[model samples]
Target: MSSSRGGVQPLMRAAELEKMSLEQLKAVKEQADIEVNLLQDSLNNIRTATGRLEVASTALHDLSLRPQGKKMLVPLTASLYVPGTLDDADNVLVDIGTGYFVEKTMAEGKDYCDRKINLLKSNFDQLIEVASKKKTVADEAGAILQAKLKQLSPSS
Candidate 1:
């Protein structure tokens, strides 16, 4: 039967799907699942990076608002805080990766965060596009398997 929403359905018949071995169908499903999972992991990484960029952007903005020479609690470690004063609110230390830091003006730091956030979001969008294609393949394979199963049933 032709589906109301489409002009033509898939050409593969139930009989053709039934001819395919179960092992092959299962393999296709497994491979598709693995690819989708990897893409999801990458998306998670992008999300984490986005959060970090946002926090950095906010910190820079707050620093710019603070009066010069204002004493503040500086984080030396995750749990350790050191007494420090905001000597130059216009300057900031930006980590450029591999434990290397660059001293930049407040505006520069914000710009850096904006660039990183945009890059991460771009990666996230690309991953989503790829994952959607993988999911479509996985779904089609699943449909074939279901069709074959239905053919094997006595009710069919």
Candidate 2:
């Protein structure tokens, strides 16, 4: 049967919903319960990840500002052709495998810096939109679940 409003079925009242067959009502209750639990878990995960992202952003800022000796700073300077540049030059090491200038182990520092920037942007967007939506869904699901539970136990 076609519904009148926006080609969709009208929402039912809590009292009206309790009149459905046991099997149909049971399925709806199960779905609502699952949605509530899933939304709660997702919110927890997003919170934890957001905290980590903040820490990572702070660390990246510190690293970017921190002074570095010759060797630790070479990876950030993209100009490979600059010869006899004395700034932080003593720390440069010749790679045994490739005979090219390589910063010992601090190369990963650049990677981490890039990762931190991207993560902050992406996660912030997700937390604002997806996480917020999930929270709304969980709230609605919680209401549906509560109504179903009360239907099953009318006196409570």
Model 1 clashing residue pairs (backbone): none
Give per-model TM-scores.
0.81, 0.40
Cα RMSD for candidates in order: 7.3, 11.3
**Highest lDDT, which number?**
1
In terms of lDDT, the poorest run of 10 residues in model 2 is 1-10
Q: In model 2, where do residues sit more than 4 Å from their true spots?
A: 1-16, 70-156
Worst 10 residues of 1 by lDDT: 1-10
User: Tens digit of lDDT per residue, candidate 1, span 24-133?
Assistant: 66666666777778879999988998998899899898889999989999989768999999899888899998999999989999999999999999889988987887
1-156 in candidate 2: lDDT tens per residue? 113422212233455444655555455545444544654576577567556656544644555455543234324343454323234422334232355555633345445445655765676566456435434443444466567667779583
Please identify model 1 stretches exceeding 4 Å from their true place: 1-20, 153-156
Quick one: best TM-score, which candidate? 1
